[model samples]
Target: MSQAITFKNRVWENAGLLLFPDNFDEKKTYPAIISIHPIGSCKEQTSSNVYGKALAAAGFVVLAIDAAFQGESGGEPRFIEDPYERVEDIRCAVDYLVTLPYVEENRIGILGICGGGAYALNAAMTERRLKAVVSITGVNFGRLLRDGFAGGTPVESLEAVAKQRTAEARGAALFVNNMLPASVEDGKKAGIEDIDVLEATDYYKTPRGRQPNGATSVLFSRLSTGLGWDAFHLAEVLLTQPILVVVGDKPGGFGAYRDGFEIVRRAKSEKKELLAVKGQSHYDLYDKPEAVSQALEKAIPFFREHL
Candidate 1:
């Protein structure tokens, strides 16, 4: 079972859903796992809803959290998406988990989905308290934004972001980005036929995966920092914890397939594996039972052995 909770992340409070193992007891210590959601998502969605219970059932105390500045968390300027702040979110989760008497501080691990996965990998690079990490379809947001999903987006495009940020600094209203088409029919009419885009729209905009706070939009001003950030920065040098990256074989539906491979290839972790789910797309792993199960099979054993 899971219950709503909140924890300190600097001065702001991060909202979360904490799940415990079956037959849980406060008397015994248990390994804890911090599960983080994707950009533009909340604890009520993928992090808590999809992977949290499954990981908890495997006997790991799980804390699925909403990134600060979003969801039910307290922060100024709601919907902000800053990569550095996200890394702090993970570290602060560890801070809170360690305070619980029943949590085994040294055995803490982390699970991150979509963009959350990338942030997890980045956080684990320096957050040694995280003994193990499981990144599911982790996308390198900055790289994906700087370079398009299939290829390159001109570096000059950043100029537009700079101007937008300046305008916001000058008291202009915060601009928001609509991450997906309102409907599939609208996308088709606009001649947007990317399967990845379509499937994502279907998932986030439809009942299949929609959450009240998971509209998948972001504030336009704070985006430049994310565009400038690299989720895998210095991963080859400092990432030594055991890591397992699971991605779908179908390359589209976001570049996580490509980024996941890059994570395993670049992470200096002595024990790292990249599992490719055949015939599955990136979004398929979001809530698809079969695909999520395939990832959890590898994640559960991997975390158990490492943490």
Candidate 2:
């Protein structure tokens, strides 16, 4: 059975879909998984719900959620992305799951897709409640936003963002650009390393993955809260927790997964595993059965072992 649920975390309310196992035994606790969608996406847009359904079929309670400022989650000036608040959202999901009678509080895990993957790792560092973490085609937003593709630093990028922030404070409307173009024909040409972004657009802007709230933009004239997003420095620390990093072998996301794996490995985390699926692109895992199933096959057992 599935139903829409609303829960509070501090002052804000978060909305999510709760899928319970068939023939659910309320008297006994079961492992639960909190599936988080990508940036600019809601639970219904991605395969997070598909995976939630699969996991529920496998007897795990699953909660697929819309992050704050996106979908049905409570936040002002919708579609804005705040990395810090997103991490807190993951923690909030954990808190809500623990209170359910059918959930095993100590066996809860998190699965984050794309940008949500980075947030999952960020939450794992401070929120010990997450027994295991899985990141699928996840980008290190802090690294990407601060340093672009080639090379740069967070401080250098912040200067540009700071100017934009100042202009917005001076009555300029802050623009929100779609990560993927609105139309493929009009989409920006992909650079050598941007095949993933192109593939992402193919899915996000199409009916296959599109939802009413899936693709959206927001204008923020307020500078104070609008332009602030810090990098996730705690990734190195988060490696201490059990984590599984999954990436496609395609050009775009594979490199990021390799780079992230190396960083986590160097951190000397003992329970980390990296899996790369051959011939799969970043978007293929979003709704494609073969790729996603292969990942879940590995992921479900990993979480079962650790959580």
Candidate 3:
């Protein structure tokens, strides 16, 4: 049975929900999985809840959270994205999970969707308690903010973005924009190139993935904080634990996942695996049965084996 629970993130003083398994036995310690949602999306918006339910049904206790400043979590100046605080939120979730009588502290694992995926990787690096990690359609926020997609712009451009944001902050405008831009027109139009699939637009704009709280952006003042978000840079060095990276074979997100998989593989860590789902697009994996089931089929076993 799932009951609403809250835990605080020391960095932001925010409390988010902890979704547990239905048949959770207080006397028995069970394996736990921390599932993080994508950017601009809350725990309930994306497939995190679905995954949580599925994993819980498979005999695991899952915690699906709303990141700090988003969803039901507590925070001021809503929608602000603090790269460091977000990572710390994951640690806080882990802290809360381990304290539960039904949770297996040493066998905890993490799963992140979209931007949350990147944070999951970052958490694995520092949080020794995370025995395994899985990233699905994850975006490297730092690389995207600094270099844009496909490395289209120089890192110097971020400073200009930051400067503009600083000016906006001084004016106290709050700079509201939808979480993920609705269209390329909403973003830096000149830098981004068009792709065939509606991966970005479909997920952020349509009801399929969009939520009332989704697509909101913090003021430009938050740019500096987000620019420093390099979640995967140290994957090669700190990822000694087991990892499983999943990607869709369809256009738009496939290449990035491939690149991420390669980066993790080169880490020379004995415990790593990569799976590319055939005929699936980035958004397809979010709630689509075929893709989600395939992913869980491969993932649950991996965690069971490793964690």
- Local accuracy of candidate 3 as per-residue lDDT tens digits, 185-210: 65445454544224666566776666
Please give, for residues 172-265, the per-residue lDDT of candidate 2 as tens digits. Answer: 8766666566656556643433677666767877777778888744332222232344324645555577888888887574245554565456
Computed on alpha carbons, the lDDT of every model, listed in order, comes to 0.88, 0.73, 0.72
Ordered from best to worst lDDT, the candidate numbers read 1, 2, 3
Task: Kindly provide the TM-score of model 3 when superposed on the true structure, using C-alpha atoms.
Answer: 0.87
**Residue pairs of candidate 2 with colliding backbone atoms:** none
**Candidate 1 residues 74-133, lDDT tens each?**
888888889999999998889999999999999999999989999999999999999999
Q: Could you tell which candidate, 2 or 3, scores higher by TM-score? A: 2
lDDT of 3: 0.72
* CA lDDT for candidate 2: 0.73
Task: Note each model's CA RMSD in angstroms.
Answer: 1.7, 3.1, 3.3
